[model samples]
Target chain A: MTIGLNAFLIIAGLLFAIGMLGVTLRRNTLVMFMSLEMMLTAVNLALVAFSRYNGTMDGNLFVFFIITVAAAEVAVGLAIIVALFKRRQSVMVEHLNVLSR
Target chain B: MADLLFYLFAGITLISALVMVLMPNAVNGAMCMIVSFLGTAALFVLLEAYFLAILQVLVYAGAVMVLFLFIIMLLDVGEDSPAVKPAKLSIFAALTGFVILSGLVISLFTDPASLPATPAFEVAENPTGLSANNGIPFTTSAKSFGYSLFTKYMLPFQMTGFLLLAAMVGVIVVSKRITETEPEAETTD
Candidate 1:
């Protein structure tokens, strides 16, 4: 049997939820950032699925933009994370609470 | 056959994602993320978005994972402390995630009617549902994407370029070694 739209959506939702779980439960900034990227890929999957099922190019096109934005975000975010780690000597989220103080 | 491939890729994606989240070692987690991303790229191929699949492999699996691994290795990241007894907050977070996942799955199964397949989906057995757009044929080829981006989305394209430039400058500035004269420059690196 061919895959259906619903199946694709469910997979997307599952990935998104897993990413969310990682974001909440994981304490490492690097892993947390990776989780964020997972969520973006999940969104990309959903968009491509919708684009395929709806017979339109909008979703696919938007996926490109999303990818572009995600790339920029990852670069900047990683740079900041590295700098933070260099300054603090730790990548644990709880240990980097200077602003909360 | 196609459904089997979908399930296989989906299984790979989901399992690797779970492992990435649950694994205590940062390096292992990053490796799992690579597998998950590759699985996603496979799914993209299944969906016939060949160009997107190629980009997914190149960007996510190749560049991004390499960058993550580089940072992890450069920092000499060690395994997370053993979590023999997880903290209370972690339990709550897991509960929240479970509730969300169950809610989504339940709604998906129970409300298929409200989420009924659209007419476009019904018009073709090919799953791509390649219906004619408003006077424009639709395809997922890289060329078609370029056409739309340059035509309908040109402004946004330029905007994304600017955004990338800003992010690049911001990263360089944030990571640069600053003089001790500036109070904001707290780190020597």
Candidate 2:
């Protein structure tokens, strides 16, 4: 009844692919950001699975650092998004051409 | 039982994630993201990462998601805009993604036994002797986690604190308002 490591890895891969799809297809900045977070979560899952099967704590430690960095990233990324919305009055990625001129 | 739970959690995780992406309403998407995060936390628990499971719920589902919802409401991103037209590039992107996914599936399933074996540690040689009581050495208990964090990984831990501080400062700088009366600094130069 035990799930093997391969199953977890495969699930992680699928999740990562889904996240990549969201990033590529979505136009909204917030949704794109959420997709990026999804990708990170997938990576964390893979690391934990490896850690468990390897009987080590290194992967777990790496996951802890990733979670910390992701929190900071969310704070700053949301702030940037808010600023962009104020300037352009839209959160659509298509509208973001500030550097193009 | 564990296999069943794994499948359940995995199903929840993937479904919610798909919903998050497919839902047009940003609010609904955020809610789905929360559910996905919860499913991920459940998977973490099954992996024996207890601390991370709690942190995932608290940090991702509890805090980060609330932040996203707050912004979604504050901006008032109503359903005013129509769905974006799919450009030609979207097809290319989808094709590329599919190719990558297929490659990963092939390699992973091709040689299942090539996966690294879980490192085995002798119970008698455990440094802290904490596992001696349970007869399971190398278990990543919170105590051992703390031990490794403070001793072996202290530098990276400190660096993460610095990174957070820098992010906080950057956020403040980026979000600060520029008054209309102020001269256009870039143009003036």
Candidate 3:
């Protein structure tokens, strides 16, 4: 079958579902981060597909801002992960309940 | 040709996505995720969103994924800490996700094509990356976008910028504590 816009949309949805599963199933904080990125990628794919289908630049422009915010999120998220690791010497979600540190 | 590229990249994307989830090492999983992101970017190009495709490569794959990799390596999380899946919870979650995805696909196939028939704009190429495409853009749609960004959407844009600044401050504060705690490294003076 030809990979039309519909195909792309389906693939994006599948990716989003897989990402959601990863986020819910996995416990490692780092893997969770990767799953979050996967979610973002799925959204990006959806945006670009809609942009192409509608033949409008609006979705593409929105993707630009999403990219900006995603970058900032990663930088700050990594910093926090590093900080948390320094304190606990572990990156498991279950072991990170102490908010004070 | 397009279908070939799509299938190729889609296969790469799905496989890497599986690797991302199934990998034992967190660092390796993150790397697999990076590959998936690149495949997604290539798919974006095939979809004709050239600008979004470039931004995907530049920002998400290049910056965000790299940051993830850096943090993963920095923390050095490994095989010793095997990630456990809670069996009962995962089965429920997986079933829910599968049902949702099925619904989405069904709805998508049934959805009517009411999408507007506007001509796709040719994305300007600035390989040198020397100039701001924003300031020079004078197309009617480009002008409308600029107006919306500065007028209707101005508040949201400013809020996002402020949030980024706050995140930057937060990162700095957190990293500084790490530097101060290392007394032996401090004693190297």
Candidate 4:
């Protein structure tokens, strides 16, 4: 009944798929962005799993850098989203109805 | 007990992520995301990544979720807006994603061929030495991460500093409002 590598890997893969589905299906830009973050977290989980199983700091360190980059990405990305909202007045991707507004 | 915990946390993560996807209100979705991240952090702890668990809670569940919530509220998107018809291409893509996930699950769980020959040994039981074969032992201690980040990964670490600085400046400039006199607001792209 002990968990193994496959169990962790499968769970990570499932988490990633959920995120992928979310991003594609959601209309709101912010929800899609949150889904993107979920995808990133899923990958980090897999990497941590590998690090634990393989007994390496390399995966963990890679995750460390990923976290740093993700924080920066969130700040910049949300700024862009805010700007989008300012211009279009809607954060739903479908509402961006203009071809060249 | 460990198996039960693993499934519990994994279920928490996947289900919350699903809720975040399907939730109509952005604020509710953000809340679900926090739960999902916390579940992942718990999984990290179960995997023996103590420092990563802490970082996951602090950086992801703390700072990132706060930023998301603030933006969601600032935007104040219409929660009652029904799901717009997703583009046909997007529906195809989502279906493809589901197919891929199902295939992975089948191949991984039902078939022993996909399983590893050797069981994964726990790092807590037998720590691996660095590839450089240096004196540094691989451990999940925060101090160990500091040593590795400083010594072996110095260049990239410094680059991360630059990236963060650039992001800060970009966010400020990108979000700043222009005066009515400036033509910058007029140019739409």
User: Which digits, one per residue and each the tens of the lDDT, describe model 4 over residues B74-135?
Assistant: 87783837656667897888879777885877577656677763455534333444555453
What TM-score goes with each of the models? 0.88, 0.86, 0.76, 0.88
For model 3, the superposed segments whose C-alpha errors exceed 4 Å read: A97-101, B83-92, B95-159, B178-189
Tens-digit lDDT track of model 3 for B31-116: 78878988998887777655566777788778777777777667777553645545687768776876787587757654646333
- Model 3 pairs whose backbones collide: none
Say which docking band candidate 1 falls in: medium
Q: How much is A96 displaced in model 1, in angstroms?
A: 1.2
Q: What is the C-alpha lDDT of each candidate?
A: 0.82, 0.83, 0.72, 0.83
- Give the DockQ (2 decimals) of all models: 0.58, 0.56, 0.46, 0.65
Judging by DockQ, tell me the better candidate of 1 and 4: 4
The TM-score, computed over Cα atoms with residue i paired to residue i, of candidate 4 is 0.88
Question: Tens digit of lDDT per residue, candidate 1, span B1-189?
Answer: 888999999999999999999898999999999999999999988877888999889888998889889989988875774543447978696768767785876587447685776533332222232335542234655677777777778999999999999999999999999776876565756
- Candidate 1: chain B TM-score against the reference chain B: 0.81
Per-model i-RMS: 2.5, 3.3, 4.2, 2.2
Better of 2 and 3 by lDDT: 2
Ranking by DockQ: 4, 1, 2, 3
Q: What share of the true interface contacts does each candidate keep?
A: 0.57, 0.61, 0.48, 0.71
Which lDDT value does model 3 have at B118? 41
Regions of model 1 farther than 4 Å from truth: B82-86, B119-136, B181-189
Model 1, C-alpha of B83: deviation from truth (Å): 9.2
Q: Provide the global lDDT of candidate 4 against the true structure.
A: 0.83
